[model samples]
Target: MKTPQIVELTSTDIDQYIDKLCTILHANVHDGASVNFIVPFSFDDAKNYWKNKIQSSIEKQERTLWAAFEGDNLAGSVQLDYSMPPNQNHRCEVSKLIVHPDFRRRGIARKLMAQIEDKARELKRQLITLDTVKGSKAEPLYLSLGFEIAGILPGFSRHPIENRFDATTYMYKNLAAKFDG
Candidate 1:
């Protein structure tokens, strides 16, 4: 697969790519993503969630939405939540990192995350925080990318398939802003 381009999706782009985004999200949820949704994630549910949560947040400049595309096909996406108290303006939270099931193992998530971190640094944000289901695929990825596990919240959320609760791992990276000599 050719290297996919990352696009900062505006509302119009979100409207255009919402279907693909829902598809990827649905697949991830059903695949035990533990990303705030259960296994019966329907297209409508995902669409509504994105519209109300992501699109509005982006328009309000409280969040930044980015998508990865391969030849016009949406491959993956990640979000950065920059809205916070004034004193915490240098921090942001990374959330909703999802790649299409078919596009996994091809470094789609990695590329999206790299872009997220770069954008944070560009904005002079020195701290990035995120949480994922403990022991999920994402935990290792976050760790590999230099995020340290801050703590674990037991029963943070329930697993999609299992009725039992799953722990959540909160991680953070204190990025040093790049300075040009």
Candidate 2:
């Protein structure tokens, strides 16, 4: 299958992104994946969250939101936040990476990550960090992509349905040396 093409998501893209995020969140809960909420996530809440995220990103002017689309359908997404404190402005944080249930294992997330890295480099960011639920299938992917496990935080989150899940892995990579323009 052809991977979805990544595009920079602006405020105009919030509605579509929210729809996709709701799908992923519902699926994760259905699959018993420990993200948050339960199997029946409220689409309204998801929409509200994405709306805030988009507005915040725009206001901060230090974040980049990228969405992967197959034709007119959203397939996945990843966000890069570049608003570190003064001394840490060279670092970025990766967050809200989600792929549709039917779109897993086809490198969509990898492509998103790569695109975000390119954006980070373009902004002169020197490091990237993110937290993923422990035992997630994404752990291997991150490690394979050269992200080092900074550490693991235990009992970091509790799935409203899954009851309790242990740990969230923190990963980061130095992107400065890898920059090529």
Candidate 3:
């Protein structure tokens, strides 16, 4: 696949790509990605999530979303949430890094992550945090990207397709050090 073009998405852009975004989310959930959904998840569920939850956050400027596109197709997306309290303004959270399964192993997720990290730095955030299902494919990716494991929460989340619970690993990167003297 050709290199995807990563673009920061505005509220309008979110509306325009709502269906593609929902498709990616639905596919990931069904593919057993621990993305807060279960096997019976439906297309409407994904649409509601993007429209109701994510779109509002974008409009409120509480979070920034980025999408990776390859030849008019949305290959992946990720979000950077910086809507912390005033005391925590220096920190941000990375969430919902999803790539279409068909587009996996093509560096789409990495590109999406790079976009969000750049956005975090632009917003003056010094700390970037995220959580992933322990032992999931995303864990190694996060570690490879310089995120250090902060802690692991036992039985923190339910597996998307299975009845068993899954542990979650919280990871963080300290961007402050990179910018410090």
Candidate 4:
């Protein structure tokens, strides 16, 4: 997938979002993403995950899902989670950034993150937080995108494939004035 078209989706786009998200989640987990799932990743597992977790969340206005398409195929997606405590209304979590294994290294993730940042700023979410497997490829990507590493939690999760415990890096970016020039 080359320069896939990225668009923000809502509950109205539930079916398409579920289909694309299922594929992306399965591909990422199968490719060793170490996200919330263990090995034996299956398409049904991915499909149900989105149908259950994401569909309701989007309906509740707690998350914004963005989908990327490569010639009518759902290639990737990233989500912004606003389901935070009332006190932290100015912040949100960036989670579930995934790209199909076949669509890796095509700048889709970068574009998704950029659009997410734009969305956060638009919503006046001054602070954005996210965590990824420490020392994973995504760590550097977050760093390069101006997210500051707050800390790392050791043995945060176990690799679904390698079976080794890995740390998780906590990152934060203050977008209060970013791109407001």
Candidate 5:
């Protein structure tokens, strides 16, 4: 299948995309996807969280949010945040690389990742760092994309309903060299 296109999330797209994202998050919360917030979170709460995300992205020095599209549907989303202080100007953090369950294994997440990496390079960010829930399907994908495992945080996350689970695997990708090109 041809790859879905990745585009910057616009003001109009944020609300609808967040709605779909909340749907995906709701499903995952039931099955346990260590994002943020405990399970049993309402869609309203998710919308509020994403609302802030959109605002933060609009800040010139904060973040850039990207949404993946398959035709007219919102397939997935990701973010590249550069809110580091003066000393850490060269670094950025990636977060919320999520795809709908029906859209998994279709290269949507990779495309989104690529989009953010491109933007990071344009923004002169040399290092990109992020963490994924341990044992999640995305971890291997990240490893394949050249991200190195920096460390693991044990019991760093707890599902309000799942009792307890391993924290997350912190990973870093040296994009400075790649950014130079």
Candidate 6:
């Protein structure tokens, strides 16, 4: 696949690409990605998630979403949420880094992450935190990108398709370290 062009998605863009975004989310969840969804996840469920949950956050400026596109096709997306408690203004959380299964191994997730990290730095956020299913493919990616494991929440969530529990690995990167010197 050609390299995807990454763009910060506005609420209007979300509305325009709503179906594609929903498709990406639905595909990932059905493929066993622990992305806050389970099997029997329908297209309507995905649509509601992006429209109700994510779109509102974007409109409120509490979160920023980025999408990776290969031509007109939506390859993947990631979100950086800066809406924290008053005392935690310098931190942001990375959530829902989803790539269409067909677009995996193309560095799309890494690109999405780089975009969000840059956005965080631009907004003066010092700490970036995220979590993924322990031992999943994403764990190694986060590590390679300089995120250190903060802790592991054993059985924190269930496997998307199975009835068994899965552990979650919380990881963080201190962007302030890069700016300190």
Which candidate number has the best lDDT?
Answer: 6
RMSD of each: 2.9, 3.2, 1.8, 2.7, 2.8, 1.8
TM-score-based ranking: 6, 3, 1, 4, 5, 2
> lDDT per residue, candidate 3, 114-143, as tens digits?
888888989989999999999989999999
TM-scores of the models, in the given order? 0.93, 0.87, 0.96, 0.93, 0.88, 0.97
lDDT of 4 by residue, 1-181 (tens): 2568999887778775666677778878888997789888888898788888888998998999988889988888889998889988889999888888888888888999999999998888989999999888989899989999999999999897886899999999988766342
Q: What is the per-residue lDDT of model 5 for residues 71-134, given as tens digits with 9 covering 90 to 100?
A: 8667778888888989888989998787877788898888888888899889978888999988
Candidates sorted by lDDT, best first: 6, 3, 1, 4, 5, 2
- Where in model 5 is the C-alpha error above 4 Å? 16-18, 59-61, 178-181
By TM-score, who's the top model here?
6
Model 5 alpha-carbon miss at residue 59, Å: 4.1
Task: Provide backbone clash counts, one per model.
Answer: 0, 0, 0, 0, 0, 0
Off by over 4 Å in 3: 178-181
Taking the tens digit of each residue's C-alpha lDDT, what string does model 2 give over 1-181? 7758899977665654667766665665566665545546677766666777554775568677888888866788778888788978878999777787778888899999999889988987888999888888889989999899999999988764665766999999888766443
Write model 6 residue lDDT over 62-141, tens digit each, in one string.
Answer: 99999999998999999999999998898999999999999999999999999999999998999999999999999999
Candidate 1 per-residue C-alpha lDDT over 1-181 given as tens digits, one digit per residue, 9 for 90 to 100: 7898998988777888888989888988888887789867789999998888888888898888889999978889999999989988879999899998888898888999999999998888989999998898899999999999999999989888779999999999989655231
Two-way lDDT contest, 5 vs 6, winner: 6
Report lDDT per candidate: 0.89, 0.78, 0.92, 0.87, 0.78, 0.94
What clash pairs does model 4 have?
none
By lDDT, the better pick of 1 and 2 is 1
| lDDT (C-alpha) at residue 94 in model 2 | 90
Once fitted onto the true fold, the runs of candidate 2 whose alpha carbons sit more than 4 angstroms away are 16-18, 29-40, 178-181
